[model samples]
Target chain A: MGHHHPGSVSPLRTLTAAVRHHRDRNVGPVKTVKLPRRKLDFFASVLQRFGELHAPVARNGHFVFQRVRRWSEARLEYTRTELPPKKYFLPPRETLFRFTPGKGYVPESEDLDRRIVLLGVHACDIYSLNILDLVFNGKYPDPYYQTRRRNIALIGVDCIPDQRCFCRSMRADTVEQGFDLFFYDIGDYYLTLVGTALGDDMVLAAGELFESVTPDDVAEYKRRSQERHQRFQLDVEIRDLPEIFEMEYGSEIWEELGAKCLSCGSCSMVCPTCYCYDVADETQLGSTAGRRVRTWDSCLFATHAAVAGGENFRHSRASRVKFRFYHKQRGFVAEYGRPSCVGCGRCSAVCPVGIDIIEVINRLRGVEYAETEHAATR
Target chain B: MQATKPTVGIFGLTGCAGDQLVILNCEDELLSLVDVVDIRDFLMAASGGDEFSTLDIAFVEGAVMTRRDEEKLQRIRRRAKALVAIGTCALQGGVPAMADGLDWPSAVRDVYGPEGDGFDALPARALHECVEVDFSLPGCPIEKHEFLGAVADLLNGNPPQLPTYAVCTECKMRECDCLLVDQGRFCHGPLTRAGCRARCPSYAVPCVGCRGPVPDPNLGSAMDVYTSKGWSPEEVVQRLRTFGPLPTPVPAGEAA
Candidate 1:
């Protein structure tokens, strides 16, 4: 029902009435703000006013999320940022501690007090961050990652998939949670859904820049969401993934993947949820003072599974390939009750040799397709 | 008491001495490094002696493109306890290796005319082909940080950490846009080894793979990206062959 007229009631009174109605409903309030397409840049600038704003920008003919100096630099329509937003939380190279050769190691603390606004994040990436939160914040929590996570804010936006994207299959195409704010393009206005209190605070802070969403805006948002779902070209039935991975442990598909895989570690590096790391100590050139650093490590490396005794647990290429898939699909679910892959299509996009996850899943299902041979070679 | 510093030598052969220049470019760290390691021989930085001497570590640059180069590499290998190949030219035969499949004599004649007869040259080959290499630090011009880090590792009795991943790893870390996917450019980042910190991509240039191919580079997938972008198989192969040897040839009868 559209609220076309409020009998000349004050805007604040109308807002209070709406909030009270939502409170009475005994459910979390869903607040939506509308920003005209022309004012999208204004909203971005507003975000920048608060803290460092990172959004997708064109770099060397490709789109990457970089620190923006101006609102015009942000590419809201981008399909995907080359790398996921995980780098902000968990950097590739991070100092864990500083140590003296004879003395014990001293833990290195980072300054995570600065505010950072991650803008234009895709729904898939938001989902990926949620998955990372579970891992980093569970059991023995990572203080460095946790500190950084707390300092940064997330703002998600809707994305149109290229053929490579399979987030829909993984139920990551639209996120119900994990973002402070989620934006959906509806005609000339952006329908901004305030998912958290932080999002509401942001909306309130920039109150003059946004208006309350109309009933027509809501309808348009729903229509566009439906359209986005239908547009996805790739789909994997994730419900069957655990069973499929378990049953296909001895399948020849892994061998095919092994043949195609270079084990160059591109897929995992670009993946938002791949969080394995290797820690090393580096002594200074002349001094005994040194720092201990941890760097991103990939499961695909032959030495990744190698033990101190020189026995490699997952020695064969086929085994490593199988291990990676099983870890993401079956093992992760077994441990965390969910698959690790959010299906952002980064692995497929960056796999120099075309080892697409969708195609692999299809082939695992024995789907007769001409592209299977080509994918196998890739 | 002056503790005996680990003896180290820097040598170059038949390519651009860019890798050595990169080491010298480490202006801040260079002076401090000399205190940790003995600079037995560094012709580029010093001219103490040309004669080969026993050393604890030898950092060799360039590729072996002649009998003299091969002999020099063997001598270094014999004298040094550890030999580190510095730069793509030394590690993978680099630009010099591009002439491998071509007729050497004719190629040389084409470049130098009849006067090329006076020059004696051989097909370019990696240093490891002639002698054992303890480690390899690969790049067009080796990343200064990596060089410094590797030397530090060796001094500490730790094996120098080299990147086992592709250039895509660094590119992703740097958050540089994927040229291959977004712009349909033939970037070899996913197939090339990392350590250059995605330099080319950071500046918006396509990765020409100056760091050489990763140990298990997925050449087929790299080719697929190019082909999907409307590049011919020949064009893909040619682009790939620019930095390192092609993994496989595009079969005959494929559209050029």
Candidate 2:
């Protein structure tokens, strides 16, 4: 269960194949190239011609995706950023439109056309963006999200999985598409995979900086990929887990977790796929005009399921907690043919009370667990 | 403008009056607020309105710590169609209420000495204990934007929507590293209500729960998180009680 390979019989398999097929069909064949370690800075400098550059930078003793004036400021080797790259697409707060008594509503177009080159993203993050694309680009598409998607260029980089990372188990440890360029470290050189026409343009613009990948480079890339695969310390079984969630609908574990759950909404906020939001209108003082706005919302919040006339659909903490898990693991499977979680483990790292996803899933699968072993301290 | 403007009053009781001060601190929006709403009675900023006239909305701050405070609150509730309780003092019986079970006479004597004999102060209680509160905006001193937003909602004939999630929501949204999880620090962000925008955590300072507890605070697990970090149960409870009473979680057997 812990050592499943990519394209295994799991919920993520179909979606992963779909994404790869879509990219291969649209962008011709993926062009594999190599750039020397020393020329990385030179390559990044050339990327500035396309758009403003952003990369992971140290902030308050943690990493965050920030705009960098120079390539030296970007921490390409950072483990994880506090917030996912989703902040670029679905912002924390955004004004949809402004309304006036006589003029009606005017849509806001601020920052929609700004181009950005987001650098050093991990595979899980890029995959999460693909999931978000499915949601935001569906039947009722969001113009704001679609515009941002078009403006921002994703440049993904390979990462070493930390103790919290479970991307390998979720099949998100490696990405084949949804990024302009994906770089894998192979000692002295980076084996880059170009997935889009824009990526080809970036390489062509760089001239001699990028070199063609030889047979030895391909062998070295395979060796490093295998090494990275073995480094994942955490794992969760995804096969038949959605059915298990359905069977455990009446389990006492939900009540116990609810009693222990803080309902802080931290997990959802840090998550890459939890994209629920709440919309509201703000009226200006001494005027009939106002602006409609939306902010990130979580199903764990008491008010998330609340309605008018003092009625709450999920009034109990146990029910709300159950709803969050069921929605991600079961409900999403029915709708999108896959679970929504990318298994990035940001939720595990950010939960103040240590409500880990891996632990919960393992418990639901009837694995025995002791209190001291699963304590919140670790 | 006077024909359509709502008559509003601001009142204070026993706390630091910091919540009212936050309103006064809204310098840029203060004139705009006065332009829209008729400032009938605000002793801190203006005092020319008819104090006896009926008020459409009344903003009350501070806790009820004296007999006079109770009477004033009852009067304000009677004359106002909508009464909003602002700040942790009025909503959750802040700092002053921390001495509820302690010896009051000796405690007062320790501070005021001989002058304390004539000081008749009742135990600190929240405004809801003395009168019906229409709405509550909780913070040590209510956040300026929250106060302004609530007022704007009331003026627009809509119920004010306050965030029900914990401070960790905003803290994560601001991309602040979790003080409790990342570092071995004591932060009340998990149990404390949001709307302070994770201000303390953004500066790398741990939250002290000045906004009081969230509606569904998991005290058991919060204690577990603290204890696992080497804090004793007594230490955790004492820290939680610093801002207000730690709400007791309903027993699992009794919970819905």
The digit string of per-residue lDDT tens for model 1 on A201-253 reads: 78878868888888888898889887777777666667777897788888988
TM-score of 2: 0.92
DockQ per candidate, 2 decimals: 0.38, 0.67
For candidate 1, the TM-score of chain A alone relative to the native chain A: 0.87
Which candidate number has the best TM-score? 2
* Docking level of model 1: acceptable
Residue A69 displacement (Å), model 2: 1.3
User: For this target, which candidate reaches the highest DockQ against the unseen true structure?
Assistant: 2
Model 2 DockQ reads 0.67
Error of 1 at A32 (Å): 4.7
> Model 1: per-residue lDDT, tens digit, B1-256?
3348888899999889999999899998877988788888899998875466689999999989888998888888888999999998898888878766888889999999999877878878888888888899989999998999899888878788877677777877777666776677778877788888899988879999888887756566456557778989888887777765666643322313
lDDT of 2 by residue, B135-166 (tens): 99999889999888888889888777788789
